[model samples]
Target: MQLVTSVNSHSIAVMLLTVLALFLFTREKIPLETSSLFIIVALTVGFTIFPYEYENKELHSIDFFSGFGHEALIAVCALMIAGQGLVRTGALEPVGRVLSKLWASSPKLSLLLTLIVGATLSAFVNNVPIVILLLPILTAVSIKTKTSASKVLMPMGFATLIGGMSTTIGTSTNLLVVSVAVDMGMRDFGMFDFIFPVLIAGSFAIVYLWLVVPYFIKERRAPLMDTSPRVFTAKLMITEESASKDQALNELILKTDGMMKVLRIHRNSNDMYVLPNSKTIIKAEDMLVVEDTPENLKSYEKILDAVLYSSLGAVDEEHPLLEEEQQIAEVIISQGSKLNNTTLSQSRFLQRHNLIALALHRSGKKTETVLKDIAEISLKIGDVLLIQGKNEHILELKQSRELLVLDATSDLTHTKQAPIAFFIMFGIVAVAALGILPIAISATLGVFLMFLTSCINWKDASNALNTQVILIVVASLALGGALLKTGAASYIAHLFVLSMDGMSTTFMLSGLMLLMAIMTNVVSNNAAAVIGTPIAIGIAQQLNLDPEPFVLAVLFGANMSYATPMAYKTNLLVMTAGGYTFGDFLKVGIPLTFIMWITFSWLLPLLYNI
Candidate 1:
C-alpha cells in the first residue's frame, strides 16, 4: 500500500468540512441533528461536484450516504430499543430496592456499592438506563438521609461512563469504533477482546469516583426552597398482598423510622375510620391518609407495597391507579385558576381534565381530624395537587394558565413484565458472547422478542431511537470515510509522526490519546471516535507496528467524556437533578479525566508491550 505524502485539494476540503462540522456540533445555537444533516448534504454535494480519482476508480457521491443503512447503525438502533425494554418494563427496579435498603444501613458503604453497581450494570446495559434507574432512587435516598444529592449523583454517573468502556456493546460509541475498525480492513474484535485493558484502567477510575470525587463536589440544595421541599397529602390503600397488610400501625411507623406520618385510617369494608394509634391494626382494603412530599409519597408506596388512591374510589389491582403510559406530576393552583376555591367534586376535576387527582397539599397546614372525604375539601389558591395522566395530557395541563406546573414528572414502573425483559436482554448478551451470531443480529432478535412479548410497544420503541445520536453517527461515518478515502487521514498521521519524530511508540500513543480526550469533551464522542480511529491506524502503519494498540488508544480516549456536562447526556441529567454548576463539573471532571488518561497511557503500553 502506498501513502499520499502531500495533501491535495480534496483532502483540504474534507479537513475544512470536518472543522466546520465540529464547530456546529458544539454550538448551542444550532441543534445537533440539524448540523449532522447539514454535514451529510455538504459531503454528498462536494464529492459529486468534484469526484476524487484513485486507482482508476472514481469515489461516487452515493457512497457517502451508505452510512444511513450501515450495519453499525442497525446495531445501535436495535440495542437502544432493547435498553428501552429494560427501562419500560422496570427490569432494574429490584436493583433499586436493594440499593435503597443498603443506603439505609450505611451511607458510606452505600456510595461505594452504588458506584460498583452502576459500573457493573453499565458494562452490559446502556449507560442511559443504568443512570435513569438509579437517579430517582438516589434522589429519594438523599432526601430521606438528609444528604446533598450532589455528592452522589456525579460520582455514580461518571462510574457508569468508566464501565461503558469495558465492553463493545456497553455504549453506542464503542459500537461505532469497533464497526469502523472492521470496515478499515482490520480483524473484527470479539465482545471481550479489549475488555482486559479497559477493566484494569477502569478499576482505578471507579475507586477515585467512589472516594475522592464526592468530596470535590459541593453540596447544593434542592429547588424552589432551602429548608424543605413541597409536601402533599395522599391516601395509601393497602391491598391483600401489601407488606403492611396485617401489621400494627405502630410497627409500620417504626419500620419507616417515622418518615411516614399516618393521620387516619379508613376501613372501607366497615365504613369506619379511626385515628392512627399504636394498637390500631391495619387490614386489607384500608386506606391510610398520609402527608409527605411527592417523591416520598411515591417512595413509601413502593416500601409498603401500597397504591396511592384518588378521592373518587379505592384503586384495586384490576383498575390500577398507574399504568405504563401514565405519569405523575405536581401542579400548583394559581390565582384565577379554574379550580381555585372550588372543591374537587365541584370542579369535576377528573372528568373535565382526563386526569386523576391523587392528593392535595397546603403550605404549613396539617389536619388532626379524620378528614373523611378529600373530594369535598375546598381547594384554595397556592395549594399543590398531585396529578396522574398521560404525557400529552400532562403537557396540555402545562400549557394552561390556570395552574403552575412543576418541572418534575415521574413515570410509573411496569414490574409485571420485568422478568420477560430481563430474559430478552440476557439472551442478547449470551448469544453475542458465545459467538453464535453477530451483535447486530442478536440484538435485533432480542428487540423482536421484546415486541412479541409486549415488553415495549411500537411507539415506545421508536421513541427509544435517539434522532440526535442517529444523525450524528451517520454523518460522522460519512466524514470519517471521506477522510480515509481521500488520504486526509494519512496526511494527518504523517504530520503527527513528523512532529514526534524520534519519539518512542509509547510517547506517540500517549499524545494521540490526549488529543482525542480533549476533542471528545468539546465535540460529540461518536465524531471523535470515528475520525480518530483511522488516524490511529495510519500512525501505527507509519511506525511499522501492529495497529491494535493504537486503535485501542483511540477507543479509550474518545470515551473520556467527563470534563463537561455537554459532553454526555448523563451529565446533563445529574446537573439538573443535583443543581450543580459548570464549575462543579470542572472541579471533579478535569482531575478524573487526567487520572484515567494517565492510567491508560501507562497501562496500555505495558499490556500491549509496545
Candidate 2:
C-alpha cells in the first residue's frame, strides 16, 4: 500500500484512478468512448497539475499525449479506413451473401457456418473489421430467417475473439505482445506461431457453442405474422367523393398521420402491381393494401371514404410517389444521443432531417407505428431506425454521429471497385506477413490507396476511424508505457513471484492467465495484455522457462472476454441491439469463460510442453 509519489508513479496512479472512475461510473451505463476520453483528460491533467521528477528529469509533458501518434493507433485507424473501402466497394458482400445462403439451411447449421466463417475471417483480418462486415449481414439474415439476434451475436463475438488470436496481425494485442517479447531479447513470433493453439482453442469453443449454446439460449422468435406489433397490413378503397380521388396514392399516404406502405393498388378491375406515378389520380372502387394500424386506418378510412378489405396478400409494387420523396435507411442510435427519448414530431426528424421513421427494429422486433413526436421518444442504445427520406437527405442524416446507417444502398453502384479494393488489402497483408513492411505502415498505405481509388469517399474515411477507439487505444498505450517506465510492472511482478515462490511452473502459468482474464473484464483486453505481458515474460525469465508459453498464456487469456460485456466492444455493440441486460452477459459469458479457462489450462502445457 505504498503511495506512488514519483512523476511516473503519479502519472500511472492518475491513469489508474481515471480508469477506476470510469469502471465505477460507466461500467454498464455510458459509451466506452466517452469513458475513454474522460480517462485521457484525467491523465493529461494528473500529469500536468502534479509535476513529479522521473530519473532527475521532470516527466515530459509530451509523453502523456504521445500515444495519439503511436504506431498502433495509426494502424487501427488505417485498418478501419481500409475496412470501409472493402465495405463500400462491396468486396465483402458477396462473401456475406454466400454465408447467408448457407445459414438458410437451419439455425444449428447457420450458427456453425457463421462460427466457422467468423473465426476464419478474424484469424486473417482484424476482428473489429470482420465484425463490422458481418454484423449487418447477420441482422438481415436474422430478419429473413425469423431467428433471434441474441442467439447468434454472442457466438460471433466469441468467434472473433478466438479468431483474432490465431495470427500475430489479427489483433493489436498479439502484436504488442510480440513487440514486448522482442524488446526483452526474446525471439520474435512468426505470423503462424500462435495459430496451432488458437485453432485448437477455437475448435473447442465452436464445439462448445454448438453443443451448449442452444440449451442456455432462450428462443426469441418474432411473433407470428398476425400478432406482429409493427407494419400491419390493411386494405383501403377509394370512393368518388374521397379527398384522395384526384391525388396520387403516395401523396395521400404521405399526408396521412401514419406513413403508409402500399403493397398493391387495384383500379377498374386491373390489378397493377406497380403503382402509377404518385400523381396518379385515385378512382372510385380502387382497392389498395396499405400498411397502417387500426386507429390510423380508421382515420384514413374516414378521409378516403374507403371500405376495409382483409386478405393475406403480398405487396409487390413500388409506388412512384413514395419513391420520389421517400428513402429507406437504417440508423443505429448511439447511447446518450440527443435524439434519445425524443419523439419524431417533437424532435422534428421529418423537418430537420427530412426523414420519417417508417419502422423501428429493436432487438429483433420491428415496430412500424410512426412516431407521433420523435423528441418524446426515449432513445436507447442499439435502436435501429428504418428512416424514409430523399436520397440526399438520408446521406446528410448519416453524417450525424447519433446514427449509423446499416445498409449503404447508395454506395452499391461502386461495387465494380471490389476487386481493386481486395487487391489493395491483400497487398497490405502480404507485405506485413512477409515482414517487408511493418503492419502499421502497410495499413496506412492501404488506406491511402483506398481513398485514391475512390473506394470510400474521404468523408466516410474520416468517420470510419472510430475516434473513440483511437483515443482509448492511445490512452491505454500511454498508461502502459508509464507503468513500464515507472518500474510498476517489475514491482508488481516481484510481488507476484514472492507470493507464489514455491508454486510449480504449471500453476504459475495458469495463475498468470487467470489473472489476465480477470483484469480484462475490468480494464480492457489491450490494457491487460500490455501490462501483463512484461510481467509474464519476467516471470518466465526468473524461473528459467521459455517466454513463449508464458506470453501465449497472456494472449489466450486476453481473448477470453466472455465473462463481461465491458471486456470487448462487440459485446457493447450488441447490448442494446439484442436487448441484453448486463446480467445476461454474465449468465452466458461466465460459463464460457470458465470453459475456455479450463480448456486452455489443460491444453497449454501439453501443447508447449510446459
Candidate 3:
C-alpha cells in the first residue's frame, strides 16, 4: 500500500509500524506483554531517529516513555486492588444467592434480574470486577438448572460492558479516552458527563443481549455434572427458614425435585431415629439422611436453606466445616487402594487424611440403601470422591496410591462478610459520583478500609494487579502520544472526512463509530480509545461542530469489544468456565457489534443534538 503523501514521510512510517504491531497482536504470535513492550521499544527508537518539531518543542524518547508514569495507569491499578478486596470478602454473595434462587425457579426472571442488577452495579463499579463476582453464581445456576454456562456467561459479560460504558470510572478505556480529550485542551469531563448517551445506546444493546443472544449460541456444558454420575449420602440439617418446614414426609420428598431422596430422619428433640412415614412432618433441627446427586444438591440447598452436616456431627448448622483456604476437588479411587476394601465409618478416614470427603460418585446405576447400611457400605475401585481440603494436603494425596485427582477445582464463597464489603464499595462510588472526592482519592481510601477491615490481605491485593494489562495500557498511552505528535492522527481524520466528502454529519459520525468498533475488537479497547480520541477531536474541529459528541463516540465505540475472545480481558476469563470456543463468540457477538454501531449512530446524534 502506497503511503499518503499529505502526511510527513516519518509520520506515515510510524502509522505503518502501528499497523504491523496490531497485525502481530491479532495473529497471537506472542503474549500481550511482549507485544506491548515491542510497541514501547519501537516508538522510542522511531522518535529518536526522526523527532517531531512544533515551534521549538521536539518529541523526545522520554516523552514516548512517559505513559509508564501516566495518571490513568495508576488509577486503574488502584481500582483493581479495591475490586479484589470486594471479591475476597464475598461482597456480592447476597446478590448472587438471590439471583441463583430466582434462576432455579425461572430462567426468564433470572435473565431479567441479572440484566438490571448487573447493569446498575456495573455503572458505578468497574465492569471487570462486576463480571468476576457474578461468574461463579451464574455458573452454579446454569449447572443446577441444566442450562449451558455459555448461554448465561456471555449475556452477563455484555451487560457489564454496557454498564461500563455509562460512567467514567466504569472502565479503563473510558478513563483513557477522557484523559486524552482533556490533554487535547478539552475541559475535564465529570463522572456522569456521558451517562445519558450511554444509556440510550446501552438500552438497545441490553435488549438484544437479554432477549436474543442466548438463542444464537448453542448450549455448552460441563462434563462432571452430567446425569451419568453416581449419587452419595449427604446429611442435611433443617434450619428455621427451611422451605420444607412443617411439611409431610411425602411433600418433603417432592420438594427435592428429583435431586435428592430422604432415606431416614432423626429427631433432635427426642434424640431418636425414625423411619419416615408418608404423613410424618418436618421440624426445625431435624436431621435427614439424604442421597445427593451432583446436579441437584446445590439447587436443593438453595431452595431449603439447609446445611450439610458431617457424619461425626462435629459441625452443626451454626459452624462451618470448610475453612477459607479449603477447596473442593473430585478424585477417583485407584485400584488396589486401602479404600477398596473398607467403609468410611470403619476406616476412620478423617484420622487418616487432612481432607474430608463431601460426596462420592460411583459408576453404574445408582442403588438405594438405608442410612445405617449405606454409611457403612464398603468402597469399591474407581469410586470418585469430592474432597474438601487445602492445596498442600491434596498434592500429598496425589503422590500416594490413595486416588487420582481430577481436573476440576472449585471453592466455597465466604458469604459471611458480604454486607460490610458491599457497603464499602457503595461509599466509594457515592463519594465519587457526588464529586465529594476525586475517584483516585476515593478509590484509594476504599482500598485502605479494605485492608483495615480484613477484607483482603497484602498478598491478595498485590496479586490482583495484572501486570500484563498494566503493560498494555501504558504502552498504548505512549503509542497514542506518538500518533498525535507525528500528525498521523490528523492524517487519519482527514482521510475519514475525505471518504465521506459530501455526506451529512450523521454519516460522518456513524463512519467514525463503525471504525472504532471494528478497531477496538481487533486490538485493545484502551489502545483504540487512546489513538481514536485525538482523531475524533480533529474531525469535530474541522467541521465546526461540538467536540463532545465526537469524543463520546470514541468512548462508546471503544467499549464495543464483544466480538472476539481476545477483544477483552473478561472474555478470556469466561472462556474455560463456560467451555466456550472462538466460534461461539462469533456466532453471537459479531452481528451484535453491527447492531451497536447502527444503534449508536441513530441514537447518539439525537441524544447529543449533534
Error of 2 at 282 (Å): 23
- Candidate 1 stretches with Cα past 4 Å from truth are 224-413
8 Cα displacement, candidate 3 (Å): 2.2
Candidate 3 per-residue lDDT over residues 339-434, each given as its tens digit: 655787787764467755555545432532221244366775445555655666765554331333432322225545556778888888889888
Q: Report every candidate's CA lDDT.
A: 0.80, 0.67, 0.71
lDDT order, best first, reads: 1, 3, 2
Off by over 4 Å in 2: 1-58, 105-110, 136-149, 179-187, 222-292, 296-355, 358-372, 375-381, 386-414, 541-544, 575-583, 607-609
C-alpha RMSD values across all candidates: 14.6, 8.0, 15.5
Predicted structure with the largest lDDT when compared to the true one? 1
Q: Which 10 consecutive positions of candidate 1 have the poorest summed lDDT?
A: 222-231
Q: lDDT of candidate 3 vs native?
A: 0.71
Q: Estimate each model's TM-score.
A: 0.73, 0.73, 0.70
lDDT of 2 by residue, 559-588 (tens): 788777667766766554454666777887
By lDDT, the better pick of 2 and 3 is: 3
Q: Give the TM-score of candidate 2.
A: 0.73
